[model samples]
Target: MKKLKILILLLTAAISVSAQGFEHFVTAKGNQLMDGDEPMRFFSWNIPNLNYVEDEMEFGRTNPYDLPTEFEMRDAFETVKRMGGTVIRIYTIPVRNTDFPEDAVTFVEAPGEFNEEAFKVNDMMLALANEYEIRIIFSLLNNWPWMGGRPNYAAFRGKDKDEFWTDKQLIKDFKKTVEFTVNRTNTITGVKYKDDKSILCWETGNELESPYSWTKEIAAYVKRLDKNHLFMDGFFAIDGRTTVMRESLADPNIDIVSSHHYEPNPIKMMKHIDNNLRVVKGQKPYIVGEFGFASTKGMEAVMQKIMAEKDIVGGLTWSIRYHHRDGGFYHHSEPLGNGIYKSFHYPGFHSGLVYDEKDFLDMYRRYAFEIRGMEAGVDEAPNAPKLLEIVESHDIRWQGSAGASGYHVQRSESAEGPWEVIGYNVSDAAIQTFANFHDESAELGKSYYYQVLATNQGGESEPSNVVGPVVYEYQALVDNWVNYGKAFDSKDIELVTGDDRSFKEITSRAKGKKGSEMLYHVEGELVGFKVYAFEENPDTSSLKIEISGDGERWNEADTQTEVYASKEKNYAYQVPKFYQVSEGENIRYIRISFQDVAQIARVELLYK
Candidate 1:
């Protein structure tokens, strides 16, 4: 009788724990994703910066990849919630590359060595997902070398990239990564990652071009370590192939299959989705893990097909970037689109006009709610913006609110008290690289505390963090490229416009090639001037600046300009050089000559 009672108690305890585990996780049920007992479907986004950031393009910052702060993580989650999204597929966890700077941060520092600090950020990401009731599809590795990927893993053993799949030593090193990630405990929640409900699935890698043999072994390994979460095969070819391998479909360990669609043709994209749906019919749930960079109509057509198909569980847009903790949105000009479309932000902005970002996001929000069989009600007021820095009266920057359309700048004599409105209805979207509002009305010599309130169609957010005691120093003439001819005289300069970090507007910059020169007519007693230049290669590019009292006689300004060259070659590098003039130099005209292709974003001339 005693033995019988003990056996029954043990069985009941195991059942209870199993039941609790299934309550929150997303499970696969033969072509359907189940949330508890109901089917789960969503139209969502891919947030690449959810864990690690690669777009930290702040001025003078050498290294780009850093662990995102809690503020940044929360902002991304909140943006997804506002967009009516339930799931967000984050980019792959970073691995350290041999060529990376010694100080560069990566999640997998070595074969079995994980960075605790990097993983802590990931823990916070999962914790936020749980708090926000959002599900995450965490990718484990990368096939591309954007952040360290398969090549880096192979390099560790001094083997070729192809060996990562077939080599025994390389496979062992990868499995160790899998085991560590699956069994690691979340510092905040004190729950193992395998048991966390916030994770929707664990993708093998980001758009990996892995062979079937490697995926099968890795998928089984992941399932062995994690029985609660579903495993997704991340094998994909960039050539717009939509069908999953038969080997992947037959594997018991692979619970979900996905395909990436970048086909610009709407009919082709839909046809591809249908082909995958037919292939995975009744075997496992299928998802369009990533898709976009098509026309608004084309993307809408793809979304319609995903929603209409019973077997297609969900689809995430190519990507969405959120507000950076330091201030402004993390910008990535998608090279695939020829640098025309940047990653979409919540509620959209004019910066993404070429890609129909505003219209597409609206469509995404509507579809995101519709697919879930729910109505998207009125959006709430945006969260408060963070006041990042007050460079000067003319150069004010802040971290943008997710859904905010514009901002109102207020000034106060003291930190806490009666404030005066200095600037109203200022658009942060007018500029790229940073969210800026020039306080032109700020009087010289008057030191005042400043705060900003973000506004949108929904409502206004609370005041941003206070930046104070800023004394207006000089009356400055700032040209940000919009009115190019008004500030500088150069016909050889071409006005290049699009979603590029090099071009700043509200004033846009001038693009100059070799033998091109621009002359700026200085209106005031020139104190000093700072030139913001974007050079592709500083080693080969040179810009000469000379001052002339008379239009004929010119003297070169004796100043050395140091521009930090980044290792990443995809984006344009900003080289901001400041030249100081002695107190009483009668300078009338400033001439700038470009020796190589370069973009001059802005020129700030400081004067009394």
Candidate 2:
């Protein structure tokens, strides 16, 4: 019996040591995230709703979203574990529902009290993460009020939302919550929550636009209680250029440089990564904590190459949603779904809506694995495109390269000798549509040799087949183009629209929902629409564009899929403007409802 007891004690010690060692707690080592001697690299997921629960009837929340059952939570983590995912980023705080307008369930229920159920759910979340060997980054708060964020926190202290950073009492209250959360004993492991190894880092909040001092203070507070884990400043490029980025990068307590990206242009996306990498300056590793497009687009290669070449720590896609609960592959997300989805859910892809679908998750896995050092065959030499036209003049068209960003249309006097750049950045188009390129240098009907080469971040592809001694002529893109007057011109269109009141008199509200007036009259095959934001960029989550006929019943537009607002105010450059063919029934009224009342700029419609 003595021998058996001694053996059992040895095994327990070994187990404890193993967990501690693997917590491997990552630290920045000259731009590389290192764990012990082995470099720490990962492909992770941003699961904003991992701990979300159906609003308990007593909370007065009336949240329509369903919470994942304990079993579902296990399955979710298990699936991530199987998919080569090393980390799971989850939201630890749930705040007010900005859209529906209600109280929300939060880890910190009040000034000094913690929600019993919320904590229990987190205990389960941490345990499951530990069981699956997945590390977690817990975000403590939110920027927007959707999750009862800063606003809710301040309201609880009887202070204005902006006072969250400066109010001494409020800051102290924040420390109390932080102390309780980090020091609280885990119900599952019997180990204190802060001491557990499953947690990777503590984030101050989700893209919060708060003061840098507040972040430093909170991070200091957290470190005082639990010195084991790393800290992250949830600094986002929202509002105008501010000290947020500099403060975050220079802060000693913050361990990682995290930037969220949503740019569609590949060139811009790569640059965004570069900008983030530049700030780290080798003192810390960087991660694109969030980024997304409806599809792989052409990122499979760009992301893998940059991560490996730049020695980036890792990337967490915008989100992963429960297959069964959050609407399947084809389910519509908030702002309402666009009969067809691009995979980003309603909330966090900027406006919080990030969920799953079969193809989308598979794409996520493809990039995830690629980022983890798996070889993806995206760098192979692209096949030479077959030039669709034999042209010697300025106007020309050709096939697109499979993995190319743009093409170089070259001009040569000989069929086999030298080629000069006639045009470049000729955009890549769909497989079925030929790319159009023009050379202003070409004389009409001139005999010239032309060959095109595909270009991408990877490198240039083999020159396309030569098309020579061909004559070409300029083709006008449009004939007799006319600018129809704005939506205010009632005589030019069927509907006369105004919001709440005349556009000039309206004062924009940063919070709560604002609405646009209805334009009613007649209807033509309502062809397309153009719109932009007015002044300061609005919150991406706060906008609704609906078409109502008879000034009564209404339907939302597909373009609304992209809210005019983004977490980064300037990324939106101008208001959200788009032109698309209208679907559904013809309506008499057009109305728009969204947050950020001041963001509206202009709206115009075109019809024949």
- Best-matching candidate per TM-score: 1
Best of the candidates, lDDT: 1
| Regions more than 4 Å wrong, model 2 | 1-23, 54-62, 65-67, 96-105, 238-244, 323-360, 374-608
lDDT of 1 by residue, 1-608 (tens): 99999998898656434423235688888889999899999999898878988877665566667888888888898889999999999888788886665678998888999899999998898888887888999899889777788998998888899888899999999888888888988787766789888899999998888899999999988998989999998988333554777688899999998988887777888877777767777688988898887889888888888888888899998789877665667777676864555788778777677788888888889999999999887678887888866867777888778778778889998999598988787766666654477776667788889999998888999998898888876767777776665566785888766545543211256788888988777666677776777776656546888888776898887655767666554345465433344433887677788878887777777765
Model 2 steric clash total: 27
Report RMSD (Å) for each prediction in the order shown: 4.3, 17.7
TM-score of each: 0.91, 0.54
Worst 10 residues of 1 by lDDT: 499-508
Give a tens-digit lDDT track for model 2, residues 135-160.
88888877766555777678876678
lDDT of each: 0.79, 0.56
What TM-score does candidate 1 reach?
0.91
